[model samples]
Target: MVIEKAKLFENTRERWPATVYVRPSKGVLCFVAEPSLVDVYEAVEGSCAPSGEWTAEDEWTHLANWSFHQALWALAERSAERQLHRNDVTFHMFDERMRFNLSDECWNAERIEYEESPSRFD
Candidate 1:
């Protein structure tokens, strides 16, 4: 089922942790905002799915991405009519655009449509 964007956000908010934000953008069906290293580690430790097979060690980054995408796939499979490839969703971590303080109120995920970029060139 082809879900509307509004419904998709509603479902994502209900299913994912408040720390995780998912939205749709051009060329991507879903985009998970930057995640915190701590959150990723915790997910890996708590995961019961096949992604749990990965240890939060040397390749923790890859495992974190895999685990997150796996969760995304399941969510889409349940609610979306279109098939989603692993590449359809993406996420990154530790970018300068975000601060790592998990307790920060600004970290809460929400749908925000910025009227304009701070930099015109961006």
Candidate 2:
């Protein structure tokens, strides 16, 4: 899916000040940020609370939580790029998704695409 825009949740902004980029070809959204690994774990864990005791046999119970946690961790560590489909993201901690403010200079998808592409004139 083509990404029309993106926005960081107010809480996310305060936690991880990163630029968001959309990869239209891959149909994924990327967040480029430099947050401590500890912070990433804390933020993701806080957002997704797993019920009951976590064990190898009970791993299924925390699938969604773990999935997001891994993604967040990857983004923070920068060992590998983390990309998520628009449908996979819940936006805020609520059911309703937040609208991206296109006016924000930091989340410019066009500029990112332009920079990533090879210029024929070069």
Candidate 3:
């Protein structure tokens, strides 16, 4: 199943503490716990090219690309859409972009889990 769109949520108390909801073609929503931006940056920085040479910009680019892939994988695993792994998830630029605008949200907001269902959005 191809991902139609993704909704981003953030914990108000901490920076980069976020979650992403990936909606696939079958209409099932898969929730993924996203790591902090700092953590992703550090991990990408530690892995370098064969020559062991990298710049700050290169690390940032790698982090962005890797994070997107991780989100897709999370969606595939949680949605039980094993075909997504083989078919590849594609996104369109004009697709819907959703964001949860939480007011006075707490740290616990980061730990919330969404159950799978047919009428989840309805």
Candidate 4:
């Protein structure tokens, strides 16, 4: 019973939705405007499922010229679509770039998006 309860909590937390704040850092892999600026965005399940490509027009060069921003986001989109569990990820939010540990899931990257309005409701 105790073990079952623990699993229940885990499931709830995983699905409960959240708004995660990511602090900008050097390894984040995106367009960071300023040293103190933070990026903000929302993601859920498959956040990369928009009409456009993963990278902006100017950033879309070949592998040789591709910046980390393009490479990293491309990797992230693959992970999210396939639900591939990865140890690290780059996220764009508040206009700054940041990263998140994804050893267990692609869910954490999107929790904030899923729960955006929920935070307000709460």
Candidate 5:
């Protein structure tokens, strides 16, 4: 269970923010962002209703929820090098099973080599 935390930054070229995960000994593992619904639910269980259901009317509403947003912001703030505020950052998490390892790193680097390349999905 290698739980990795990442601080997200605005990606002007894309819709989602961006973050780079690294190992102290190794260089950058990969760049990632856009936490999936499963990742969000696991990170902040309280965001769900009593019945363990998401109640937001739309995806925007769900992402805008204060509790969810704050939780991720807090994570990012902790890992951030500089002093950042709520709107300044967002956060995401990944594990070894995801794309935070040497194998995935190769896929990301040499994507053209493989037809079915894996994603650095959060």
Candidate 6:
């Protein structure tokens, strides 16, 4: 089983800050941040949770409390580079069915893709 330890950041402009998960793909794998950490990271990513943020909310329902799975996509869009990139930066949001790791390079790319078609989300 994979384990994670993460830290929390606070920002108010985040959307659905209370209902999310995030792994920076920059450090320890299972040793992830707290629920608040997801909110904090979201804050920096341009999403702000003005009121209280999402904490103790995003939990795993299966193995090791690992309910949701997410990855970091960093491929340039609308560029010559896009053609060469087999991994779309937008293929970020994902469930455990996609994949998981203790410390995989799959997360966090130089550029990112929002996948999910970008506009199909609420």
- In terms of TM-score, the best-performing candidate is 3
- Estimate TM-scores for all models: 0.23, 0.22, 0.29, 0.16, 0.23, 0.20
Can you give the lDDT of residue 16 in candidate 2? 36
Deviation in angstroms for 103 in model 5? 32
lDDT of 6 by residue, 1-122 (tens): 12222111011111213332333443554333334434444444432233546422231112112212133222111222113212222222232223453224654330122122122222
Query: Which digits, one per residue and each the tens of the lDDT, describe model 3 over residues 19-80?
Result: 43333353352332234334544554455453677764443334334444454454545663
- Please report, as a residue range, the 10-residue window in candidate 4 with the lowest summed lDDT: 57-66
- Give lDDT: candidate 5, residue 35: 46
* lDDT score, candidate 1: 0.35
Q: lDDT of candidate 2 vs native?
A: 0.35
lDDT preference between candidates 2 and 5, better one: 2
Which of the two, 2 or 4, has more TM-score?
Answer: 2
Candidate 5 clashing pairs, residues 3+ apart or interchain: none
RMSD of each: 15.9, 17.1, 15.2, 17.4, 14.0, 14.9
Clashes of each: 1, 0, 0, 9, 0, 34
Whole-structure CA lDDT of model 3: 0.33
Quality of model 6 by C-alpha lDDT: 0.26
- Which parts of model 6 are misplaced by more than 4 Å? 1-48, 56-70, 74-80, 83-93, 97-122
**Cα lDDT for residue 4, candidate 3:** 16
